[model samples]
Target chain A: MNRPKEIFMMTFPLILLLGVLSCLYLESCSAKKEIQLIDSEPYPIEIPKGFPDIKIPEGNELTKARVALGKKLFFDPILSVDSSLSCGSCHLQKNAFTDLRTTSIGVEGRVGPRNTPSLVNVAFNPYFFFEGGSPSLEAQSLGPIETFHEMDFNAALLTKRLAADEHYQKMAQEAYGMEMKLFVIVSALASFERTLISANSPYDRAINGDSSAMTPAQWRGKELFFSDHTNCASCHPAPLFTNFSIENIGLEKEYQDKGRYRVTLKNEDIGKFKTPGLRNIGLTAPYMHDGSLESLDMVIEHFNVGGLGHKNQHPLIRPLDLSDHQKKDLIAFLHALTDQDVLLKPEWAP
Target chain B: MKTIKVILMALIGLTMLTLQGCDNSGCTDPDSLNFDPEATEDNGKCDFPNLTVNFSYSVDGQELTKGTTYTINGTAISFSDVQFYVFNPRVAKDGVMEATGETHFISFDNRSIEFEDLTAGHKHMLMFGLGVDSTTNATIQPSDSDLADGAALGPQNPSMHWGWDNGYIFLKMDGMVDTDGDNVPNAGMEFHIGKNINFNTIALEIHTDALEDEVEVTVDVDFAKAFTGIDLSKDYITHTGDFPALANTVINNMKTAFAKK
Candidate 1:
């Protein structure tokens, strides 16, 4: 009994010293760990070669938690009033983020006016919508959400719905350091959309030193595309494949949709629409603002006929006198722009 | 040790009691709307008397009723809907102007509106905007300061906002007119005036006193003045951007139609 007491007396001091040292080390480590858990980490994006830097709006940086939350919201149907349609419902990854419809059908089967534009590489777009009404991607999301025939939902109500979910509440604190708000919803979606960069096409590969990436017909058609006879490069220049010009391409004699005139209230802006990038054109047809042209041949023929001679037609939209063989080559070149990787990328899918 | 523990508990209880005694701050003005009877100290956020405003529509000095036939520019017309937005309301008393930075949706369905924070004195000038201002019209999303769920500047059922252009339709007058020479008013006539450039302000000279409790003010809006230079037979429909000439004439007429009663 005396021997055991002596052993306990000697071991007690050592144990007490170890206990003091452990408390100091653990307190410091726990402080650092807590900060790491609460704060969002940076999400790195691979900017395409030869493209201008993505201009992320100030106060909203790309973070891993924010992008994940945005992706979840993009696929959620709770944004709609009826909870039946989501942003992903109209923008499918299989069709390069386009719905493959003449015009998208919204909540309650309401047919919208404008064709759904492809969201592939939308980060590079200077402005949003075919009419170019919204200047930033963050503001552009509000258009569809509040439209009467689209989602038909209110932003004020969206906040309440998101706040009620514990997962969303926790994620909101992690991503934005606050509860789910209207600012959080818009900014988070914009961050995820900015990550949708598509520059791995065969044409991109060929230009980036892969000699055998493109076919002979695609090469020949590329030369004609940049030539003065086609004049396609004037409006659709390289890198982004668009110069971001809002112009009247003379698609109609009397337009029902006034296009940018609705925003500017100017007579000259009637029938004018923003020129979209041609990165995934093959996957995103029927073409034009109204999705009137059904096929690539129809689009080529429309340009060949000089666009039905509307008064507001672009001065450079005169007929492209190309042979049938050349038309086939142009179609082949457009197909070469299709990036197969973007369609099947698991990271982009739900 | 037990005696010392009792002293600490008593000291903590005393501190809590002292903190509770310091919370005597609240609205103390008897004339204010949110006057707290139990409050001993006054906070600056005391609401005052409210001045209520209601509109009356007239055509040719006659009361205009919905679905009632009226003649304007030799065309028989009947209005089915008449609605507008009133924003940035201000009342001036003795050269000291106070503005309620609020927007309200007014219609034949709901015609009464109230402006609080008025002093108990006669107001000489009453001014309010006919449409949304440039900054508010830029986007459909209302500012955080605005009543998020209130009818003022919030999303409506029929939707006062134009989602395509991301602006609000300030004034909407929809009805039917006898355009095909038929006696019955069957042809649709829609006049939607909006856009930031078309935002107009109407200032009226009113002789009304806001009592310590509340006061009522009536403002007349003549429907005939809206058709002063407009011919409903040929120029019937305008969504502001599609037919700017007719819209410009109607807005000009609307500006002169308001009078305090």
Candidate 2:
């Protein structure tokens, strides 16, 4: 046993070497890979070269995952109290994101007070609600969710349900990474909605110098729409087609219902409703807040007579006195506002 | 052997020192610190006096009691509920407006004990008006399914709006009045008061120091007094035949009434 000490020394180095090597191997195995955070696809969100950024909250840039999830959630009736109604129920894809019914039906066969508005180009709308009560798309998302006659789901319950779902968890993580929250869900939906820009309409093409986009009647209608006699352009304007302000438009003197005044509590705002954009006016039929007018011709006739004889009627509303031909031309112009790309999109289909 | 032991001890000591340095600089002990040793926390308590204002009115000869239901003309009318909202109501000591909190939205629904939550004095200016404001009106859409259960007032309940001519019935005053010879059974009037873009407002003031417990105040709004300047005999009719004419007359009438109050 003369070499016992030497033997121990040799074995010790071997053991230490093996231990260090194993330790290095374990470290290598446990180390995480670098996350490849790909930048989301850039959209044409940039305003025209000279135009200022609209003084509104910028919606988050759209992502494929978020848009996909939003589309799913939009079509899912699970958001309703009874799981019977979805956003798509009221905003059908066939009618360019508007329902044909006069008023939308909600949960438990409940009826809403106003006509279901179209969602096309809703991102460009500065204000929401017929009376412009909510200022942003983010705020508007919660309107149907909380209304007793609509979805009727408690916000807290919705949060808890979403938190529990593994599918939603994955979606949320993909859309927002680690910053996902209930409010972020709303933001993502709004972002997805903003991507629904219908700028490829025939009218847009014609305005952008495509002569073949419009017929002669539609061209004449465009002229009449902007003319002093029609005065439609005063409220409807160009591009997005709305002035984004409240006007009485002479529907009534006193309504049992106050429109915009409900938000402000000001007496002066009585009978005032938000002037809706006329883009895709052909598709979003059963017109007006109450959906009283059935056809485009009826809408023209109503405006022609200066609306109901209410004291608060907008001064801009006067007898158009358009001939039948002019009215048909105006109708044709309205039809040209329809975007084929938007209508045919498979993503929009429920 | 002794040298190896000493070297191992030194290495251990170095490791311990490194750990100590990390603890001091990097890791924080949340339980070690003390917070706010001197200040008393706010427990949301209020100590204020009380006040009351008794309202008495005589129609013809009979003195009106608080809960008495009376038939005006023929339609039954009564003060179902009454409370006051002092827009910018404040607590005051002596003659100065106090910085203390006051109560607001003193209504039949939200009955809070602390009038100080609304205002802080018996000698408070009582500005009052009748009818639901515009903000409250939009919430009550006629087609809203919730309204079917009578949660919101709409056309089915009273048909307040003159069809669609007037968007919504703003104010509803339902009471019978002496018309022609006989007291008309259903002679009632609804003042759907709203204008296009003019803010119509009413104000009234009262000074009170009468109370024993916490100061409680109530303002009496007389519907009869609301139509004081309005001639019931001529302007008041059962049916809203001339909508534009009636609307103009009512708007002017409401503005005058509010201003006077």
Candidate 3:
């Protein structure tokens, strides 16, 4: 009887000790998980071969948390004053991030003046927007938000709103290592945009010595594009396919929008617009600064007619007189620039 | 103890949330490259794309100040006040010209003008007008501006604008004319010159000092030449009434007034 009672007393204390140890371990695990959230690792960007050297801006290094936060901000309609439209509303990933509307509708369904250009490979561009008003991706980031016809939300209100959200706070703090700031918000968006690089296309492959990749029709179109007669390559060159220059293509005899002239305030620059990259031209249709043209055929026809003459019209943009067959071939060549990496990549897709 | 840790973490997060709010500060001028939108306080630190140029009035190589006596078109006059309006200044560089959209005021007190937010690093020719040009006066209404843009320079309080229909008085030269060349009391000649047709764009016959960030140059205004050929006997004032002779006299003489040095 004495031996059994002593055993029971000793076992009771051991049982209690086991229970306390398990509880402490569980608590420690939970606490460690919280700390891990704060020390989240930076994201990695694997630059494709033969692409332009990417320069990540100072103090805005890429991180998984930053990219994830940016993607969320991009898709969130809370940016708009009415919560009806997000940046992604017009910039759909499948259609090369264009709304296809003649002019994209903004907050309260207000129609914008210019066409939404595809943002693929925009990291290589030094200037942004159709008029090239904004200098960097960071500078261009704030324009749409305050533009009366676009997002139409005040910056102060946006900062306040983002700060109040618990999820945004964690992500922003994790990514930027600070609370919600305008710089962090815009920088995050631009960092994600920097990741939106499109280099994998049939045209890119052809340029990389895979001659059999492009069809014969595409080859003919390529020749015409580079030839002095067309001289399309002078502005839209190979690789990135943009000279990063603004020019007047003689869209109309008299311009209403005034294009780059408004930014530069030079009369000679009137009706001039930044030459958009031709990386994914086929996917991003309804072209030009105003989205006035409905199809690639119409755009080619405009160039073929040499564009109604204007004082500031580019010297090389005279009549092409390309045949219907040549025009079709040119379009096939344009279609050859479909970037599968930008389209089907899980990281880029919505 | 675990519950206490969770509670403490939550409190820390809440404190951080309270700490970070909108604290924006930057240039407020919309025309500047560094325009900040979220700035709540004016901060009075607005920066503009500006080039500095100083205007100095002189007659026959002799600089004149307010209450100074000088000879003009054979009439010796003592200028009590010499104030003028400088219309939008156009800067020409490398054969290309660009204009600042805003107007400016020039007076005895304010001889220095900063051409806000202009192109830098080129040999530039700065051209300005004596008064508001007819085209601008007719198209851009002064009352239409919100005043926050610093538009309509020196309006209302300084007596630049005469009336809504009459438009702004581009140049106001008030003084007493002495026919006998005596520095004594005489008839007052208020040359309030302004009209759409009377607008004169003065091309300063001087070049900037390879204008970079900011360059200071003297804009010489010849008071004598400002009335080269006007019949003082008929009318010495050109205010609201259509005194073409007086207007023409001032416009013709005002040609040689400005020179950048």
Give the top-scoring candidate (TM-score): 1
Worst 10 residues of 2 chain B by lDDT: B26-35
- TM-score (chain B) of candidate 3: 0.71
Ranking by DockQ, best first? 1, 2, 3
- Give the per-residue Cα lDDT of candidate 2 at B55: 35
Measured with C-alpha atoms, the lDDT of residue A286 in candidate 1 is: 85
* Reference contact recovery of candidate 2: 0.00
Higher-ranked by DockQ: 1 or 3: 1
lDDT of each: 0.83, 0.59, 0.74
Q: In model 1, which runs have C-alpha deviations exceeding 4 angstroms? A: A1-39, B1-84, B92-98, B101-121, B139-160, B172-192, B210-214, B220-239, B242-253
Candidate 2's DockQ: 0.03
Tens-digit lDDT track for model 3 on A52-141? 776677677778888898888888888878888888998989888787888888998899888998988888887778777555575466
The 10-residue segment with the lowest total lDDT in model 2 chain A: A30-39
Better of 1 and 3 by lDDT: 1
lDDT of 3 at B235: 54
Give one digit per residue, the lDDT tens place, for model 2 in B1-261: 999999999999999999766542321321112222332442223223444333334332344443455544343344333332222333343455532232133333432323332233345444322333444433433322223322223222233322222223444444444446344433444444433332233444445552334444543434454444555645563222224345455444543332111
Clashes (N, CA, C under 3 Å) per candidate? 0, 28, 6
Q: Provide interface RMSD per model, one decimal.
A: 3.3, 12.8, 16.4
DockQ by candidate, in order: 0.20, 0.03, 0.02
Cα-based lDDT at residue B233, candidate 3: 34
